[model samples]
Target: MRDPLTVSGPEGPSFWAEHAWLGTHVEPGVVLDTGADGRITAVRTGVAAPPPGAVPLRGLTVPGLANAHSHAFHRALRGTVQTGAGTFWTWREVMYRVAARLTPDTYHALARAAYAEMALAGITAVGEFHYLHHGPDGTPYADPNAMGEALIEAARDAGIRITLLDTVYLHGGLTADGHQPLEGPQIRFGDGSADAWYERWTRLRERADGDRVTVGAAVHSVRAFAERDGYAAFAERTDGVPVHVHLSEQPAENEACLAVHGVTPAALLDRHGFWKPTTTAVHATHLTDDDIRILGASGAGVCMCPTTERDLADGIGPAAALQRAGSPLSLGSDSHAVIDLLEEARAMELDERLRTRTRGHWTAAALLRAASEDGHTALGRPGAGSLEPGAPADFTTVALDTVRTAGPVPGLAAEAVVFAATAADVRDVVVCGRTVVGGGVHRTVPDPAGELARAIAAVTT
Candidate 1:
């Protein structure tokens, strides 16, 4: 095996993969050339062998996976929250307890390790749906954006691209009576009002690098935002940025929205013109036909976190219907129940099969698109998640000879990967022409598991 750690010169780097997935199909003996600026300069296919000095990626190489939605701190709650019987609402309480323990230093430590684990899973970029602002008692730090900045820095150290979705979370929960005030750990997430939230978001935007780090915005959910007009104002002000919101993840949320706003969460957001091509709805698990039509017609995308949905008993989403209605689908590892995007990808199809009592609801290629290109687009990184020229030089090589991925023919390798392979099968990961993980080992953070253990212990214990 060639040393993946070797750096290429001023002209840039070239990688030759045994088999490469070119969006729709797999091609053998493909060479991808990257420019000095870290964009794919050329893709030369049908080459029988690696040219001199070309890095040899001996496996099925695919575009770097994009985790379209994540709550980085939630990684800490993985095993701790699984012990007892609970629903999504109950899960939220456990999650909030973990949230309350986070300081800026500990947040950065945990997120860095979490993102490094993502890198090991072939993820090159992540959409951090961050809302943990202020101190334990809702006090702003010296720099109000300190926690947000910590996450961005953590992603940088983890050698992955990050879109910090600076979230505006006001109120605690919605009820039949009205929006409730923040209580307990929930107080840490609010920024007083929409104006105050946007002010902090504006300052955070100034830190965006526009390449590896894109600053975006999100409303935690309709239940968390009582000021209805704030959604419209946020939409208008942050028009071009990637906007995300937690849609109807639970039936109770829909019931509350209907009682308070006389519409489902989807309809309520649509009334404020929140749906758009750039906006992505995370965990849109429950939707009426009208909700589907509204989201699809607006060309907004949906991100499904199947593992988290299943772990929390959130019902299977209408992924196929939403897709047919013209909404592009994306996948995420929300709550970090599992960090495998392939698992998230396959679970979406497998869950849909269980729901409709049918197979082939989605092709493996289509599922990979959700994990890759469409996901990157939802995170404000358009023109990524492909091996075509002018795209970012980001890709991961999955070991075909691994125990899980061994038997598939070259043509069906993509199917083998999406259906059978896990994060452990990822052998190498490259982002922006830089090697972050090689030979199944992360380069920057040498021991991700150890880091994760230490970091989680700090906040949890």
Candidate 2:
């Protein structure tokens, strides 16, 4: 499954869209010109017809979707974990079993298939919240950063951009006593101490290129590290990079944090000066008012994984409230429960409607913004999610002629895309001026489903 998608040529490529959402509304007969560097040079609306030598995209085109959170290896557990009544804790036990079976080689295979699935779903960029470090028994491989590097390679092979959020997982669990020693499968995720994690991360970041893949730092969560200095040190080490952390996803996490620190997890992070402008709080599901205020005031973005949250019964997050308080909201397909950013976007609004028993909490355009521009911003791809001049030439077109989308007129095409379309509705995907998926099939990864089945078998059995 080597990459066959070509980047822009010396002449780049021209594409004409039947309709396109240019930031706010859908416009008809849109034309886009990409430069040699894979940046959009111009956008013309009302062209009515495709120019000569231009590829015609017959659908509602939107900016490339950004998957702000992902655990690629977890794709192996998709159908297997759906049985019986299980909590997140129980589901994690099964997940740990799969994690213990990974080698860097198998990981690359699995991640390649997982990322290719994301490509078919129209994801042009992904924020891999990676923590699978070291060997199975807590020993570093010949190359300590080998697992991290496999993810970078997998994204490249899938023809998508990735931000490797190299996470620090130093503790096994947080008990009332304090942080516990790394044990069992958890050991594979830890690096002895935060300083040691910093050393490995420093090396990875220095070697990581800024183009297709970049390195970012993560604290894992307050449960994994009670000490504040490690986070501070990591912040300094990854000064300009984005910092992401799992916030209060479950009520138990909030309880534990409050029991130990006398504050919410968000407040605890605030106390450590970890709330930088580029910081993103993943799954800020259970937050106090003060927690919301702190995140909003500190300019930290919130990434909501509604599909995964609902799947794991993690409860809905305060997305509209967070936005009202001044925090930007982004969507992520965390846990790979489903990689449809369109579903995630609508779930953000639909879940809110379920919670508040009201409607119109978020406009379709705002939800798309979260899945695109804001998500890219969270992943450190600033301004890469727009179709305007100077932005990266990355976009996906959804087929409005599909059974799920045929009723809507072109004027409300954006609404059809946001409210009706699924991943299957995406007919074409252009990333960095390259066609990764055309006509609902991956251009490079032949047999993504078969690849996924084989990769999962290698690990699970």
Encode model 2's per-residue lDDT on 1-461: one tens digit a residue: 45444554685798999889999789889999988777888999889999998889999999999999999999999988998899999999999999999999999999999999999998999999999999999999999999998998899888898999999998877766777888899999999887888889888987566657778888888888876546666767777899899999999888887777788889887887888779999999999899999999988999999999999999998888899988998889988888899999999999999999999988888989999999999998888888899898899999999899998768888888899999999999998788889899898888899999999999999
Clashes in model 2: which pairs?
none
Residue 290 deviation, candidate 1, in Å?
A: 0.8
Alpha-carbon deviation at 189 in model 1, angstroms: 0.7
TM-score to native of every candidate shown = 0.97, 0.98
Q: How close is candidate 1 to the true structure, as a TM-score?
A: 0.97
lDDT of 1 by residue, 174-261 (tens): 9999899999999999999999998889999998877888999998999898756377888999999999999999999999999988
Tell me each candidate's RMSD, in Å, in order: 2.5, 1.3
lDDT of 2 at 192: 87
The lDDT of model 2 is: 0.89
lDDT per model, in order?
0.92, 0.89
Q: In candidate 1, list every pair of residues with a backbone clash.
A: none
